[model samples]
Target: MRVLFASTRGSGHFHPLIPFIDACTARGDDVLVVAPPGLEASLAAREQPYRIGGEPPRDELTRVMKRVLELAPDEGVSLMTTEVFGRLGVAAMLPALEEVCRTWRPDLVLHEAYEFASVVAAERQGIAHARVAVSAARFSRSTDALLATVLEPYGPGITERLRTSPYLTRLPASLDPSPYAVTHRYHEPSRPGALPDRWGGSAEPLVYITLGTEAGAMPTATALYRAVLEAVSGLPVRILLTAGRGTDLRGLGPLPPHAHVEAWVPQADVLGSASLVVCHGGSGTVFGALAAGVPLVCVPLFADQPANARLVAGAGAGLAVTPTGGPADDSAVLGPDDVSRIRSAAELLLKDPSYRARAGRLADEMRATTPCRELIGTLDPHS
Candidate 1:
C-alpha cells in the first residue's frame, strides 16, 4: 500500500509523524511525506526524504490565525484554537497535495487532524483518509460536537457540512490513530556526542528546556529563555537548552558552567535521559515527554498551548504557565511575578516525589491507550 503523509511546514508540526512513517515503511508500505520547501532538508537529516512544496513564511501567529478563520470564522476561539487550525491547514497545500495524490495515488491519506485540507481533497477523490490528532482531548467526540456547534454560528451550513464530509467518514473524532504508540515506552540510550560536554557524566537531576522548533523563533523566545535560566539558577541540576535556528542565544550571555546551550539537539536522546522537562507545550513535546516518563512544566506561549497545558496539568502529570493573566491560577502567565512562580513550580516538582510518581503512572496509561498500527489496520483492512 502506498501512503502519502502531508504535514505542516514547521519542524514541530512535521517531526511527530516520523515514527508513524517509519512504521508504515517497515511493514513494506511505501510512505511519502509532503511539506514546504526547506522542510525536506530537516527530514533528510533524520534520513527521511519528503517531497517539497512552496515555501510558507515563518509567521506562526498570522498563519495560524488565518487557518482558524478559514475553518470556523464565527467562533470567538482563543489564539490557541487558531494555532491548532493553522497546523491543520497544512492540508491547504492543494497544489502539492493534488500533485502527490495524482502521481502516487496513495491507497489512503493520513494527516494531522488540524490539517482539514487533506480530508476535503481525499473526499473529492473518493480515497480513504484519517487524521492524526496533535493534542489530546481535541479529538474526542464531545469536543468535536461542541466545536461544530460553536462554528455553526459562523456560517449557517458549515458545521453540518463538515459533519457529513468525507473527512470523518467512519471513525469518531476522539478515537483517531496516534503516532506516539512506541514513543510512550521509555528506552534509555547513551547521550549523543553532539550534546554539550557538561552533559557528560552528570549525576545531578537533568532539566530539558526547549520551546519547540517554530515558537522558539518568536520574539518571546528570549524572554522565556531568561525566565527558565532564572528559575533554575543555583539549582544542582544540568540544564540543556535548544534554541532553534534564528534565535539569538547571545542575549543569554555566558551560560553557567553547569548549563549547556546549542542550536539544536536530538530531543529523543535528551528526553531519554532527562529527569524533568520544561517546554512550550507543543503537542509533540508534551507527548514525547510523557513517552519518556518525564514530568512537564508547560509554558504555553500561544494557540492550543494554553489548552494543551491545561490538559496536562489537569491530568496531574505537569503544571501549566501562560503569558497572560487569566483565571487559571494553576498556570503562571509570563511577567515579573511569574518568574518566581515558574521557579517555584519547577522546584516543587523536583523536591516532591509525588509529581514524578503521578507522571510515571500517566506515562504507563498513555503507552497502553492505543497503537497506531492497529488503528491503521482498521483504516485499511485490506492492507
Candidate 2:
C-alpha cells in the first residue's frame, strides 16, 4: 500500500505524523510525506519519502489568513466552530496540494485535520483518506463545547453545514497519534537523554520548561521564562529551559547555578526524567508529560492549548496560569499574579503525593487507549 501523508509546516504539526509514517513503512507499505519545502529535509532525514509543495515563505502567513476568511463563515458554523478556522487554515494550502496530487497519486491520503487542501484533493480524486488529530484535547468533548460557543454567532445552519460539508463528513475517520500509549509509560529516558550540558548530576527537583515549538516564538517567551525563573529561583528544583529555535535567549543571560537554558532538547528525553513539566500545553507536550506520569504546570498560548490545559488540570494531572485581565479562557500569558499562582501550584504538586498518583493513573489510561499503529492496522486491514 502507498500512503500519502499531508500536514502543516511546523514541528508540532509534523512530529506526531512521524510515528504513523514509520509504522506504515515498517509494515512494508510506502509512505510519501507532502509538506512545505522547509519540512522536506527533516522528513527525508527520518528516511521517509517526501515531496515539497506550498507557497513561498513570504506569502505563507497571508495565504493562511485568506484561507481562514474563506472557510470561517461557512464551515465555521459547527458547534466546535474554532475548527472552522483551523480547517480553513488548512484549506489555504490548496494550491500546493493540487500540484502534489497531480504528480504523485497514492492509494490513500492520511492527513492532519488542519490540512484542508490535501483532503480536498484526495476527495476530488476519489481516494481514501483519514484525518489525524495531533492533540488529545482536539477530539475531546471539552473542545467540542468550547468551539461550539465560539461559533454560536453563526446560528443553527452551521451545524447542518458541518455534517454535510465536504471537509468533515467525507473523511473515513479522525485519529489522535501520540506514541505514549499509556500515562505510566511517560517517563525519563534511560541514557544519554536530551538534557542540556549544565543539568548533569543536578540534585534539585527537575522542572522541565518549554513552550511548544511554534508558539514558543511569541513575545510571551521571555516573560514566561522570567516568571518561571523568579518563581523557582530560590526553590530546590533545577530548571531546564528549551527556549526553542529563533527565540532570543540573550535576554535570559547569566542563569543561576540551579537553572540552565538551551535552544532545544528532545522533549521526550527531558519529560521522561522531569519531576514536573512546565509547558505551553501543546497536545504533544501535554500528552508526553501525562504519559510520563509527571504533573504539569500549563501556560497555554493559543488555539486548543488552553482547553488541553483545562482538561489536564481538571483531571488532577496539572495546574494552569494565565496573565490577569486576559480573557478568562486565555491561559497563555504569565503576569505577576499568575507567576505567584503557578509557583504555589507547582510547590503543592511537588510536595503532594496525590498529584503524582493521579498523574500516574491518567498515564495508564492514555496507554490503554488505542495506539496509532493499531488504528492504522484497523484502517488498512490488507496492509
| Angstrom error at residue 55, model 1 | 5.4
| Model 2 stretches with alpha carbons more than 4 Å out | 56-92, 137-200, 325-333, 381-383
RMSD of 1: 6.5
For each candidate, the alpha-carbon lDDT, in order, equals 0.63, 0.64
Cα TM-score per model: 0.76, 0.77
Q: What is the alpha-carbon lDDT for the whole of candidate 2?
A: 0.64
Candidate 1 residue spans exceeding 4 A from truth = 44-49, 55-92, 139-200, 324-333, 370-375, 381-383
> Positional deviation of 143 in candidate 1, in angstroms?
8.6
- Residue-wise lDDT of candidate 2 within 11-72, one digit each (tens)? 77677677678778878887888886657768778788677775434565556544543443
Task: Please give, for residues 1-383, the per-residue lDDT of candidate 1 as tens digits.
Answer: 77878777666656556556766776778788877665767767754457776544458656665555444322424433333443334324666777778777888887754554455456556666665555554432333554453444444554444444323212112222322221221122223343445767878998889888877877667867877877776688999888887799897777877788888888877877788888888877887776667888998765456666876687677888765532455432366667767787788888888778877776665555445554455556265
RMSD of each: 6.5, 7.1
Error of 1 at 320 (Å): 2.2
